[model samples]
Target: MEKYLEIIKNSYSSYWNYLKNSVFMELNWENYFYGLIIISLIVWGLEAIFPWRKNQSLFRKDFWLDTFYMFFNFFLLNLIVLIALSNSASELFNDVLGIVGLSIKNFQLLEINKLPFFTRIFIFFIVVDFVQWWTHRLLHRVEFLWNFHKVHHSVKQMGFAAHLRYHWMEPVVYNSLKYIPLAIIGGFSAKDIAFVHFFNITIGHLNHANINWDYGGLKYIFNNPKMHIWHHSRELPKERKYGVNFGITLSIWDYIFKTNYIPHSGRDIELGFEGDENFPKGFIQQEMYPLGRKD
Candidate 1:
């Protein structure tokens, strides 16, 4: 119990220090703190120069709201709640495994650290994205999960920052689901796969940006704004009522699984789910929305 408390304490202190360095710009070139800002700027700049929805305002509706969602989801809640909970949960899970005479290390399918650096990054990227792809599908297909996911689908207008306008519960779901598969294929540190993680964030931002670029045939391999905008379309096909285009960093999965759908450029499609007119506009209201307690 004391060790558990120490872990909790250290999580808060360590992540707090990270948040301080991030906010103060004291991080190295690869820090996600500055990367978030720089990526948003670069994508927003692209949208401004060559927007798919040309008439959409420079500051689109709910633009600032989505911007706040970016930081809040990325840092604030993690510092205050998620880090401690996840660290403690990991410890408990490891203890449970130890009781079974099996450690996480026992399940290792590959030593990622021993692979070529680029191979390691690529493997981690594909596996992480594939796991998230299924998780994304579940977020739509399952009724209960969809409630938490509605905060993201409630976006009425799409922009770069809108990439991160998801419920706080989402990372809990994503990371929890990612933990086992990643741990099984373990032996790599966050620093080892930082480039892939950064690339994933960049792709996510660009996917939600108001730009239409598919990179010709490369669209088959990578998720692009053109294909992803349809994922936000209010009117899905009758057969695909739950959702479509469930890809994360890669479109190959969607293409392979037949979830990809883009009959035309989705510049003017109505965004958001059914009955979205009543969706809350304020951040607190939206955060509370999934709990059936909009304030």
Candidate 2:
């Protein structure tokens, strides 16, 4: 029995090393796609089974739109990564703002073997959430930024795809803007970077979920579905609650900013903008609206 256990451990160790070396090659498009599909399926399955709102339609008109934007969003992100790889404007931007003086790519060691899986994930979440919370709040206070970000707020309700509704430029600029500081701080590796994206995409869905779920006392610490619901409130009184619950992982920033609001009720809250009555519903319209309007 002891011999069998030793053999199992040796085999597992060898297999783990092989997996790390294989992934160290150029981006495995197959595995990349696999990771994306896995994330989407898990999120979609959760929505179907433990839906925030029981009667919510999983396939609504906005649902399709959200899905479309998800693909588009990813396309744009990959394009940026590509450009950053090449010596283009995107790379230039990354250079000027990157952690090091002019290095665009910060391929830190993908430390898959050094730690337990959960420990690595926990560290990544903490680092990524801190950066995201501040950047999200900055978008609210800065009027120019609010324009790009408003596309996200323009949504009337949260759907599975609702996480995709954002002005393309908003994320591009925001990503570059935040990553610069993160790179400088310089603790995150490639795996940590992947975890950042995984958490963002996953939590963004929860933020827009129709379910009236909350993390109970946990909302005071973490940004749950309900706290995010208020952030999208259409009522002026509620919209003012923006910037609280800034940390995607933890609501610590919101508590610090006094932006955290624990509601008395549940999913009955109205969503969307309070003043932007003429805001269009379509993606093209939302993109072009700010151009013609004074608001």
Highest lDDT scorer:
1
lDDT to native, each model: 0.88, 0.64
Give candidate 1 misplaced runs (Cα > 4 Å).
Answer: 293-295
Q: Model 2, 158-265: lDDT tens per residue? A: 665777777766665656665654454445556666766666766666666665567677767767777777677666454564544556667777888777765655
Give candidate 2 misplaced runs (Cα > 4 Å): 1-32, 80-124, 238-243, 292-295
Write down the TM-score of every candidate.
0.96, 0.72
The TM-score measured for candidate 1 stands at 0.96
The TM-score, computed over Cα atoms with residue i paired to residue i, of candidate 2 is: 0.72
228: Cα error in model 1, Å? 0.7
In model 1, where is the ten-residue run with the lowest total lDDT? 286-295
Winner by TM-score: 1
